[model samples]
Target chain A: MATGVTATAGTTRGRSRLRAALRVTAAVFGAYAFAWGIAAFGSALGALAGLAPAEAVTAASLLALLVLPVAALWAFAVPRAVMGWVLLGGGGALMTGVACAVRMALP
Target chain B: MSRVGGPNRGTPRKGKLISPALRAAMLWPHTWAGVTLGGLLMLVFFMGSLAVFAQEIDRWMMPATRVEAAGVPISLDHLSLDRAVRPVVERLAAGRAVRDWYVQLPEPRRPVMALRVRTDQGNAGGMATVDGTLLPPVGTLGASSFFYPLHYSLHLRAGFVGYWIVSFASVAMLVGLISGVIIHARIFKDFFTFRSWGQVRRSLLDLHNLTGVLVLPFHLMITVTGIVIILPIVLPAGVQTLYGGDIDRFYTDALGGYERPRTGIPAPLAPLDPMVAEARRLWGGGEPAVIFVHNAGDAASYVRINRDTGDRISLDVEPVYFDGVTGALLQHRRPGPMVATHRVLSGLHFAAFEHWPLRWLYFLFGLSGCVLIGTGMLHWMEKRRVAHGVRPGVGWRTVAAATCGTTTGLLIATLAMMLANRLLPAAVPSRELVEVAVFFLSWIGAGLHAGVRTVGNPPWSGQCTAVAGLAAACVLLNWITTGEHPVRALAGGDWAILGVDGVLALTALASWRVARRLAHRPMRMVAPTNAEVSDHA
Candidate 1:
């Protein structure tokens, strides 16, 4: 009975550790992806709004830098790790896709 | 910024901006990021601080460059660049055909003109006095080539891996800073709080918070600007979307740089003085700082002159390109508004202006960053010691070793390298590499010592003593070898040596005092109870 209890405890500890690792991974890379999406979308949108390509890129990049830290901090503030991942990582992908589409649609 | 009711479920505490759960969550990234990357941050900050005086340090190390006329800026109008400078470039090319060459004009801080030539054989560089007499190679990479590059690149050039790592740490630092401010309940109160006579833990926390809150703006500005300087390289999403990911093309467009392919037909280059005069005229009177002759000895050669940026807060030189044969203005390009804004931001970080007070503030604020990171790690170690009881765990020991290695160990390595520069034979082949090797080897040695001795407090006092002694030795050796003692240096008007030696002396004194204090008060570990020990077993 004691052995079984200890084994369960060990498994629980391992699971929590794995969850923590996943959260950290999401916080770092997911936030990075989100920032990338911001940069891409902002630049493409700026270009479509008749700004020069270089100007749009510079302005977008500056804005992206501001977004990165907040996104990273927000990743941890969210209650569920999976929610953070889905929102950051998934939102990043969707935005990046839209950016690429917009670029393709450009004259 | 405060979130309202959520799944946190914690009782709302009075006067707290953030929920307890949010604060706790922020603490994880803050603590872990500081622990893991604090060593690298310390290195970057310290190296950057040193890089602020890179030119001065270069003068200290390369004594041959301690020109008596250092403070006097050489006039481009008075010097015949084609007559005096061209022969030096030709000599550097030797029998090989000249590809291209550039000359960095003598400034007040650096009295010698630095010339670099790219020949068909390879590349060669030598310094010349204001009168264009070629001096022998300084032989050492010195601060500009080594420490300044190490600040941003970590000397890792292959695939920009160093830049990526540094940028990642910078982002982590930004995260740490913002999260830190969010979590700190009384940042304003903490700004005025430093209880140095209190317990080490409290004092470390106080110092950490004090430095963090005090220089927070500088830390943020420096980090953001540093990142902005290399944004295209680190985050290429915007570049990829707009410019098809061609960083070179992006820079050419963004910075208004001009270049053209070289023609094989040989052509005699026109006088560079005319080009400098034309560039200055085009800029409505600005000093020509660097003159670049591209495609040398070719029909397609063009001369580009960059205006001095010392008087302004923009890194833009307002480069004016001239035809090599005709010396006629080819392209005088100016950056657009957004690019100009980027240059201004970059200039803030570069701090290449002539304000000594601002330069010293940059240095001090930079060192404050080091103090912040150092105290943060110290606070962590102390906090963990209280929790973990008498004997430190493996995790604690590792952090302790790294803290020692990056803090005092870094100082030891830098001082030892400077000492090596003084002691190494002047004619030693690859003396620069030897100095660098000394730096790395000493750093490794210090790390190993810390690792081995981490079982008992990580040898902080001993390492401090070593730093004190090594720094003193460096100053002494410089005097003994170069015959330029601080007093003599001042008398002879060599402010560079005087400044370097004076800092070294101060370092020695401060380190010695710290060593004594640390030795007197060894870190106290909480004693584990017998019951607790058995419970662990």
Candidate 2:
């Protein structure tokens, strides 16, 4: 009985540590990637809407900075660490792809 | 203190906006981030506070610049920019073909105009009085050049690695602040509560919360604007996407900057006073702070004059460009709304406006940020001391040492550098580098000492005493070398030097008192109560 309890506790500790590390990684890199995507996509959309290229970039960069910290904190707030990775990382990739397509489509 | 009516009593988690689970999750990041990056934040805050008075410190360090122009307005109209400044620019070129040149007009704080020339050989610069008489090299980077850069850049300019690191820490700081606000949802209830005479742990926590809550707005604004100033470089996705990775082009478009390439055909440069007058008229009355003549002696040369931004809370200088040969106005572009907003944010962070009261408030609030971070770390160690028992572990000791090294050790290093500046001979090769070496070497020594002594306890008392000694020594050395004591400085109307001396004296007194208290106070290891234990958990 003692051995079983010890094994369970050790497993729980290990699993929790891994989850914590994942959350940190997702918070830092995932949030940054998401911010970058927002900047790129927002800039492209603004330019398409008739704003000057520089103005679009400046406004989009400001928006990205405002979103970055909230996204970083959200990674920690979520129930499952994997959810953070999927939402931030996957969504960032999708937005960036669309932004690139828009850039290529521009005259 | 009725549980029914009191805020945060009994149902601590009830009616709170932030859920318990979310708060718990945030706690981890806040604690770890503050712990890991708190030292760097301390350096940034302390150096930034000092940088508020960077020009004054420059006057203190380089005594040659303490010119008597306190109330005398710099009348550039009467002073010939061509005769007074052009000769200095040409002299700085040293017979080498001048590529470009710029002159920073003297203000009240800095009475000596600064001029720099880029030549085929290299870049050379010098300081000259408003009347055009060149002064000897001060042979020191001083505060404006060294401390200000250290605050933002950490002196690591290669590929802007320092900017990236500072930005990362700033983001972490933002995270910590948001989490702290959530954790202390009832902060408003204890807005004015400060029980400094109570238990050390409780008092430290109170001070931390007090400063954190009170100075939150300033901290938030300062940190955000600091990041905004370098946003394009640190987060360049938009720039890369829109401008094809050319940051300069984005800046040119966003900031309304104008430039032209050299034609390689030589032409005699036109006089500069008219250009300055024209720029003033274009702006409807503003001082010409900086005049840059690009592609000097070329047919395509153009002069850019930036208006002084001291009177406004916007970093935008409204640069006016003119043909260098004809002195005719060429370009005067204005920024769009978004760009204008960016300039205002940058201005708030730069605090270059001529408002002494606001500048001092900025300095005080910046120091409060240092206090906030320092007290947070101290609170953590105090709470952990009981858990670690009589003999603390390596991890605990490491934090204690780092706290000491960053707080008092940083002060020691700064004071040591100031002392070295005064002591080093004028003719010593690389005198500035020698002072910088003194700063780093002393800081390392203090850090090593903390590491060794922290086995039993942090070497705070010793380091504090050393800080007091070094600060006092710097003041004394300044008086001895420059013969400009605080009293003499006052009589001479050199308020800049007087202010530096006054701050140094206060630092000495404050450190001495703190050291005495630390020496007398016994480290009591109180048994951890249920509340304390659970707080850490």
Best by TM-score: 2
Q: Across the candidates, what are chain A's individual TM-scores? A: 0.88, 0.91
Error in Å for residue A76 of model 1 = 0.8
Report per-candidate DockQ. Answer: 0.42, 0.39
i-RMS for every candidate: 8.0, 10.0
Chain B TM-score of every predicted model: 0.95, 0.96
Residue-level lDDT tens digits of model 2 in B1-537: 011111211233668567655555666677778889999999998999999999899988888888887658876865688888998887778799999999999998888899999998989998998888888888889988888899899999999999999999999989988888876767787668799999887888899999999999999999999999999999998898889989999999998789989999999899989889889999999888899999999999999999999999999999999999999999999898888999999999999999999999999999999999999899878877865666889988999999999999999999999999999999999888998899899999999999999965799899999999999998999999999899998898788888999999999999999999999998785776656655631
Cα deviation of B345 in candidate 1 (Å)? 0.9
What TM-score, over all chains together, does every model reach? 0.95, 0.95
Compose the digit string of candidate 1's lDDT tens values, residues B1-537: 012112254565778567666665677778888999999999999999999999999999998888888766568755778877888888788878888899998888888889999988889999988777889877788999998999999999998999999999999999999989877866798788789998777788889999999899999999999999999899999899988889999998887788999879999998887777777878998788898999988999999888899899899888888999988888887887888999999999999998999999999999999999999999888776765776878989999999999999999999999999999997999889999999999999999999999885889899999999999998999989889899998887888888899999999999999999988984575574434322210
- Indicate the DockQ of the complex predicted as candidate 1: 0.42
Q: Which residue pairs show backbone clashes in model 2?
A: none
